[model samples]
Target: LLCQILHCLLILLQLVEIVLFIVDSGCSKHMTGNLKLLINFVEKFMGTVKFRNDQIAPILRYGDLVQGAVMIKRVYYVEGLNHNLFSIGQFCDADLEVAFRKSTCFIRDLKGNDLLTGSHGTDLYSITLQDTNCPNLICLMAKATSSQAWLWHRRLSHLNFDTINLLSKNDIVTLHAYFATEGIHHQTSIARTPKQNSVVERH
Candidate 1:
């Protein structure tokens, strides 16, 4: 009778442990699912507003959904300082012609400072006309020109005018020249090999 009672008690304890483990695991899984759902819901809600301001307005004004799509794509897709500096007005006759005729033009930093001495390069006249949007442009310009060579190199290295698609051949040429002038050249230290030199030479 005593042996049978002890065996029953051991079996009961094992079952209780197994049940508790299962319950804890299930609870954790449930909590994780709930957290993920909440995060997704919040992201969707915020995206709704961004979509209207950045997407819908441009579509209504332009009348061409494709152009609107391109604009939205550029606004979202392009990374770094130069992306925000470009806009629809850039297609206008005055801005477009100036961008083409002057190689040195549009070399100004966001703060309206000339990137090169006036004798060497030109500043974008339209940039001054964009004072209303200055606050945003200022932020981007500051970031790009912050560490002169690095940002300048990055801009030149990945020069994709496809999004705005208005930069002329001259614009590209001038930018390339400016980068060559301002970029830092890193020199590699030469290591001497044993085969090329006397191994037992004394100084």
Candidate 2:
């Protein structure tokens, strides 16, 4: 009877050991899964950080600068035109000139016409100066389409344009090419001038 009792105790201890081993294995698997998830998250976050700093922020800053400079120049030109018109007895108050100037000024994706008539365009120019993940100006321009340009402008109005004209030809080309390729497909309302669309027919 004593021997039988000893045997039973040994079996119980073995079962307990087996149970402990199973629990340990399950805990190890859970830890591995958590580590994998953490690693993936870190990788994605790093990629986004690199892109924002290297590409998106600079393009946005440059775009804002260019738009601002253009706005100031246009304002001066409009003022001169208004003065000339008034002097010639065109019968126009300065308010009209101010309105025209405001209309022509491109701010937050609203073009001159949009400001004048509240008829917003399908696309608006936008830029991000700092902490942007995507630096490609073309991609930024492409985002300013009929669907989301207005919303994006509303979100990013705080950005300032300091010296946008200094952007290189390559950057401009990149933007223009993107517009030509993608924008052309969507711009059915924009009729090209005959000279602009002329093509030589194959003989």
Q: Best candidate, TM-score-wise?
A: 2
Best by lDDT: 1
Model 2 gets an lDDT of 0.22
lDDT of 1 by residue, 1-203 (tens): 32232222211011111000001111111111111111112121111112313642111111111111121111111111121122324233122221223432333334554322211123332221111211221112222323454555464455364621343342423433533465622223636423336432222
Which digits, one per residue and each the tens of the lDDT, describe model 2 over residues 49-151?
1131343211111011111122211110111111110110110121222122322321222233321111112232111112222243332322444465456
TM-score of candidate 2 against the unseen true structure: 0.15
lDDT per model vs. reference? 0.24, 0.22
RMSD in order of candidates? 28.7, 32.2
Residue 35 CA error for candidate 1 (Å)?
40
Q: In model 1, what lDDT does residue 138 have? A: 14
| Per-residue error (Å), model 1, residue 14 | 71
